[model samples]
Target: MSEVMGQQKNNLELNDNFEDHDSVSDSQVVDYLFAHPDFFVKHAHLFEELDIPHAHKGSVSLVELQSEQLRKKVRLLNYKLNQLISIARQNEQIYRVYADLNLRLLATQSMEEMQLVLEEVMQERLQLESVVIKPFIGAYAFPEIQRRLFVEKRFRRDKFFFGRLSEHERKLLFPQQEANSVALLLLGELGELGMLAVSSKDPSHFNPDMDTLLITQLQQFLSILLPKLMKY
Candidate 1:
């Protein structure tokens, strides 16, 4: 009887101890660690023992995981910075070309002079194989098939079209020349005047994916210049 009573007493003591230990919650431990910042410094070995969940695979040490995350962020930032720099350099080059063309256009005294200068500059500086400024009347006079292929399909409403051209379209725009791709910019307001067609032998030279800000600006500039030139 006395042995049974002693066993029960021991069980009660163990339950009390467990209850006391359970009173210290996980938040309390985190709070205690925050209170003592030097705790990790005092126990440097804990760094090796600490395991953090990783994005892939099993686990990694806390320090190792943090370092990896920082490296990834740095790589992402570097890639973005490089893209911005590349875009800026490209914009600078485009601006220089546009400025040169604008100066030449402004210097011309007549429509013939402007056309000659425009064609020569585009071929020499811009690497275009063929450049033509077709008047609306000329475009209207095109054969039914040619008009439907280029005018009706491409410039029905859009001010600009850039991409590979069909063989017939290429031949129509650039007769006696081999052109694999073309960019057509509507010359006047709602294309009342006509269009400017620039072509290249390289298939990828003009595509819909290309940035058209520079081309759009050039179109607007020509719109202002062509009206005055036509009056001359």
Candidate 2:
């Protein structure tokens, strides 16, 4: 009977000790989990059991949230891959078109024929608004004053110019056609031959930093061809 009484008293003392202490706070639970990095490895079942608040689904397990994130990343990667493929195809097509134009220019007989070919290929195939070759001399020469102004304003340093043109400049270069942006290529090695201007209706189509690979080839070919055509 005395042993039973002593055991009862010990149980009461244990209960009283527990009541004297405060309950564990949320911060204490978080601190304990942070202190033990391998806690998830030990309690792996919590990956599926723990509920995470979801804006769209009300609640989702941690495993479901991770899966959704992976799916979104995969979709974004696929979208970027598709964009790169589309740009590559476009570049290939542009290269082929420029190649065909270069071949056609070599076969051209007269200045008029050359201009016609440029207009047809550029306007019809390349979808440019206008293409013009303004010579410094010959029967189809551009006015000297306007030519000088253009050269001073646009070709002070660079052989190629690309950007929006002023209203007056647009009228001189592409009088009959609508032009928001233009790319200008100086024709001769010494810039004595003339200027070749290609215009687009879209304002952002041409810019200063565009690559001149195809256009540079075209300009070099024209510089050789124009002198021969002008003599005849």
Query: What are the lDDT figures for the candidates, one per model?
Result: 0.81, 0.92
How many pairs in model 2 have backbone atoms within 3 A of each other, for residues 3 or more apart or on separate chains, i.e. clashes?
A: 0
List model 1 lDDT by residue over 67-122, tens digit each: 99899999999999999999999889868988888888887777679778878878
Q: How big is the positional error of residue 224 in model 1, measured in Å on the Cα after superposition?
A: 3.1
The prediction achieving the highest lDDT against the true structure is: 2
lDDT of 2 by residue, 126-222 (tens): 9999999999888888899998888999999988899988999998988899899999988898888999999999998899888889999999999
Candidate 1 clashes between residue pairs 3 or more apart in a chain or in different chains: none
Stretch of 10 with least lDDT, candidate 1:
138-147
Per-residue error for 170 in candidate 2, Å, reads: 0.9
Model 1 regions lying over 4 Å from their true place? 1-46, 51-60, 138-149, 176-178
Whole-model alpha-carbon lDDT for candidate 2: 0.92
